[model samples]
Target: MSSTKNENCYIIKLGREASLSERANELEAAAASGNCRKLLQLIRATGSKKSDVSETICEDDGMPVTNSHRCLERWTELFEGQFN
Candidate 1:
């Protein structure tokens, strides 16, 4: 589980473990182009309303899970109660 944290948001990686600093660097580099739409797209596509990106970082509860549309959808539905 990896996570990127900023003042306003946290983006967590579902499939692997990466340091917060590394995730932050990746986001910074991606944002340097002045277009973070791709970043937003990924978040909008995968984020869970209840569990949040922070969930991926705390694994003592369980190991980090993989990233797939199906997994995201299931998680979203379980957490937010909205699935379509």
Candidate 2:
């Protein structure tokens, strides 16, 4: 039996995908190269100025807040206070 053009195209695509996905070890080794801190610094350095405000969130009492919920509450409070 003969396959159609779409079937042949799909088979070729699957072969290419399978070959590309076979580099698990290389991907893992690249990820474990220990450049995480540098990557984070680069991301932060390129980030917008608006994001800087949330980078060091603190409560009204002058205590640093790490909790996501508390940070959101602090942001909400600040945003709401501007209207009053």
Candidate 3:
């Protein structure tokens, strides 16, 4: 599929996403790269941000995270896809 950016896209200031979004993305990427230390930092930093992380994952289709098991499964799937 051809990539296209929506011209009408605009940020919603009414309801901003939680800060954990960035950390989650970083952690996921680091995990894919097999960075154990980064992954641990991510888990530790995720303390009070768990809810935001879960909500973001649930809402994003690219990151299918329904349950804890599914999250790990999906992460492994993505990691394997990247390596192989």
Candidate 4:
């Protein structure tokens, strides 16, 4: 596998681990806490090619978020929607 592919796999693994651990809320919070953007940027910078890393923000419902910003939005919706 190529380096980029390896990075992608690592990210996916991280997401899966987070979801399996039932820490979606904490993950979502961390993602929306501004640091995620920086971390995402660092991850992107390490890649030789541009590829979407949104899959790294796996939703608890099995829905895949396709962008960092949208990931945050979806998490907000999922959490807040619970009350409505």
TM-score, each model?
0.27, 0.35, 0.35, 0.26
* True lDDT of residue 30, candidate 3: 92
TM-score: model 4 vs. ground truth: 0.26
CA RMSD of all predictions: 16.9, 12.3, 18.0, 17.9
Error in Å for residue 24 of model 2: 30
On TM-score, who's better, 1 or 3?
A: 3
Q: lDDT of each structure?
A: 0.54, 0.71, 0.65, 0.71
lDDT of 2 at 20: 58
C-alpha lDDT (0 to 100) for residue 40 of candidate 1: 78
For residues 1-84, what per-residue lDDT tens digits would candidate 2 score against the true structure? 256888999999999888656554445454588667655654555456563444767887889889999888988898899998
Which candidate would rank higher by TM-score, 1 or 2?
2
**Poorest lDDT segment (10 consecutive residues) of candidate 1:** 7-16
Candidate 2's C-alpha lDDT? 0.71
Task: Name the lDDT value of residue 27 in candidate 4.
Answer: 50
* Best-to-worst ranking by TM-score: 2, 3, 1, 4
In candidate 4, position 29 carries an lDDT of: 57
